[model samples]
Target: MNLQRFEQLIAAYGSQAHHWPVAERQAALSWLQQQPDNALYCQAQQLDMLLNQSVAPLPAPQLYANILAKICPTPFRDGYFYLCHWLWGESQWQHCWRPALLLGLPLLLGLFASGLSTPSVEDLLWLDLEQSWVLMMAGHEMDL
Candidate 1:
């Protein structure tokens, strides 16, 4: 590989030859051997050494509790469960409405928004065609 590509590979995968893509590994090794005093390669090796020495900090117990609470919240704290209980009073058949409303509301809103948008599909197609025609004319003018 060229010097620039070899430098990019070193930067991306560190100076370790084994970490590089299998296809490019031999080429990279050859390039590195040819230019043994590459500054980028040395810098990458130093950076990798520093990164390997670093340890990740442990997360707090409270963070786990907060994430779990959000994922599987109590009926009293969860808006969907609370709303279902308030309106339908824990009937098994009525609980079906919960999933329907959850999925339908956003879909209905999207349909309403699309209906209210100014540009129709036909209008957008015509606009695209017009832009293409203008570009073609500009290219023709440039040729002259």
Candidate 2:
């Protein structure tokens, strides 16, 4: 195994092959066989010994009770305050964009849709004027 993987394995499994992941155990064993005096293995052995030492841990007294005492209730925000917060904002410039986008996008899309669907006034008022007449046969029914 490479030095990096060997170091990681040592930290994870400790200089012992049995504790190492089953899939990686053979590779680690072969690497160890190839180099009987691996520096990472020696370091891992030292670290394992350090970890195994019977040091009395400091007592964490009232951990749950301390956390509970430190907790402070916050006021709940409704829609009105939320909208006000978004619009006015802590940074007047930074968060102003989201609210502007929310309002402007719909309005812009509406204008674009209407522009495509609605006919123009000029198109609506335009007409074609045409007439047809016969000179000899058209006047026979008129009263004199």
Candidate 3:
């Protein structure tokens, strides 16, 4: 129905048309017939022929060993190997959100609640008046 489904059907059954389910093969042929002569159709035919070719056989045991050594080199390399060292070494806590939420949300809530309960202008004025009265009383006592 979709392009992906068409591609899957082609990959699974297109390589050997004779092996395809008869009804499905007929349906696919009918669909391809509906499309005009196009570049994609030509390219698909060429690639299908290319995939069917067989390579020449390999030589002796030494040749096989040489090929294997060339294809599969040593995996370890020094330049970036030390950078891969783990700090916590795969702890289960790294995958968890509960601890971060437990620590973070209360701190955020405390800050938000602190902002809401901050002293008003009137409270500041009263504190200022109290301090001034103390200073005036201290001055009076000193004068006496």
Among the numbered candidates, top TM-score falls to 1
Off by over 4 Å in 3: 1-4, 36-40, 55-144
- Per residue, candidate 2 scores C-alpha lDDT tens digits across 71-101 of 8333443566777777766776747787788
Clashing pairs in 3: none
- Per-candidate total of colliding backbone pairs: 0, 0, 0
Q: Supply candidate 1's per-residue lDDT for 55.
A: 91
- Find the candidate with the highest lDDT and give its number: 1
RMSD of 3: 20.9
lDDT of all predictions, in order shown? Answer: 0.88, 0.74, 0.66
> In angstroms, how far off is 18's CA in candidate 1?
4.9
Clash count, candidate 3: 0
Q: How much does candidate 2 score in TM-score?
A: 0.33
Deviation from native of the Cα of residue 115 in model 3, angstroms = 99
Ten-residue region with minimum lDDT total, candidate 3:
79-88
Q: Could you tell me the lDDT of residue 49 within candidate 1?
A: 89
Question: Taking the tens digit of each residue's C-alpha lDDT, what string does model 1 give over 1-144?
Answer: 899899989989999988999999999999988999999999998999888899989999999999989898786778876675765646776567766777789999999999898798999999999999999999999999
- For model 1, what is the error of residue 7's alpha carbon versus the real structure, in angstroms, after optimal superposition? 2.1
What TM-score does model 3 achieve against the real structure?
0.28
